[model samples]
Target: MLEIRGLHAWYGDSHVLHGLAMDIPRGRVVSLLGRNGAGKSATMRTIMGLLGKATGEINCNGVNLLKLRPDQIARKGIALCPEDRGIFPSLTVTENLFLPPVVAAGGMDIASIYALFPNIRERGASRGTQLSGGEQQMLAIARILRTGARLLLLDEPTEGLAPVIVQQIARVIREIKELGYTVLLVEQKAHFVESLADIHYLIENGTIVDRLESAEFAASRDRVERLLAV
Candidate 1:
């Protein structure tokens, strides 16, 4: 549902992405797997128009994303859940869930979001600061789902979470995918990506070095792991 071509972005004088390109098909999970500083997060930022200086093409189903403002980009059926989660510290879970204006018509309602994230439902009255890291992550994802965004840009959703919580997050992602959402995931955990993503893009130095389907990833497991190993 999204296509990026020759995308270059700059944070002030620091040019990060260098001709990055990828394709995200409808209802499939595409992952950008890279080491730290490899521009994975920058790619996400550029797609969402969060970067001030981004060039080249970021097309969402033929809509030129680069020309739009960040809010406008979001209104075009895209939502980002950054590494920090971006939760309001003072807002309760229910309040946070309702904070973002629904950009389109397909967003999950409160009942559906609660059903997908039971933990969040249980903590509906808890403030963001009162939640644990995993709870915060779940809330972040839940909050975005209520925005009616068809494309989700998730940055490091599994990072720093407990194994069980990671599993829960993965389950949620799978459920969303089954429900026809397209995901552009920026992740470092290879095993997690391997299990969840349909195709993987290996990025380094702000460019995609290799692209692998799931079967290819299995065949080249050693090489891919070596590149990902820190």
Candidate 2:
């Protein structure tokens, strides 16, 4: 569903991605794993057209996303839940979720999103700032869901959540996969990826260093740990 080839991105004069290439198959969850500053988030930003300068081919479902604006890329069925969750602190949960529906094709109904995230449903009236980290994460995902986007670019969705909430998020990811959505997951949590992802791509210094199937990834624990350790 998503193809990135020879991708390079820079923030001002600082180069962050260098010839990174990877493909995410339709309806599969592909995890991008790396330690801090290894360009995982940079790749995500470039894919979402958030970077100021980028060079490469980013094709999503047959369209070239590199030539499009961020909103245009999003309109092509990609929704990003950024590393920081990007919740609007002033808006209530429902409002924050409904805000992105204006730009999307098939708008997601509140009930379905509420069903996917019961916690957010329970705190439907709470402002973004009033939520816990996990709640904020849920809000972020739910907000993306409301956009009716089929491909999700999730950057560190489990970053600061409690273990229980992380598990819940993992389950939700699995559910989304079952529902036929493609997910490009950037995460530091290897264990969670072990159970959720179909394939793994290890990136370092802005390039893809290794690509492994889930079974191969499971068997290379030591290598995975070495690459991810700071």
Candidate 3:
């Protein structure tokens, strides 16, 4: 559903993402695994057109994402849930959920989103500041699901969360995959991605160093660990 080639991005004079290339098939969960400075989040920003200076092809289906503005790219059915879950401190959970405009057809209704995130449903009247980190993360994901975005760019969804919350996040991704949404996952934890991602692309110094299907992961476990180690 998504294809990227020769992608390079810059923030003012600082350059990042050195000719990165990867593909995400429709309805599949693909992961980019890398260290802190490995350009994982940069790639996500570039794809979403949030990066200022980017060159190269970011094709979604037949549409050229590089030519479109961030809002336009979103209207074409792509959504980014950044590492920091962007919830409004003053808004209630229900208000936050209804804030983003629906960009396309076939978005999940409030009932469906509520069903997927029962915790959120239970706390519909609570302000964002009243929620726990896990609840906030769930709301972030839920907010985008209402936008009818087919391709989800989840940047480090599991970062800094407790083990149980991480598992819940994983489960949510799995459920969305089963529902036919394509996902581009950026994560540092290979273990967190093991059972969820269909393909894993290891990145180093802003480029792809290796690609592994889920089947090859068992054999490449040690190599993946070494590369991820600080």
Q: How do the candidates rank by lDDT, highest first?
A: 3, 1, 2
Question: In terms of TM-score, how similar is model 1 to the real structure?
Answer: 0.98
Writing each residue's lDDT as its tens digit, candidate 2 over 1-230 gives 88899999999999999999999999999999999999998998888899999998987767878899998987788888998888899999878877776466765677777788888878989998999999999888888888878889999999878899998999899998998888999987788899899999999999999999998987887898999998
Clashing pairs in 3: none
Give lDDT tens digits, candidate 1, residues 152-215: 9999999999999999999999999999999998988888988899999999999999999977
**Highest lDDT scorer:** 3
The reply for model 1, stretches above 4 Å from the true place, is: none
Looking at candidate 3, the ten consecutive residues that score lowest on lDDT are 55-64
lDDT of each: 0.91, 0.89, 0.92
Quickly count the clashes in candidate 1.
Answer: 1
For candidate 2, the 10 contiguous residues with the lowest summed lDDT are: 100-109
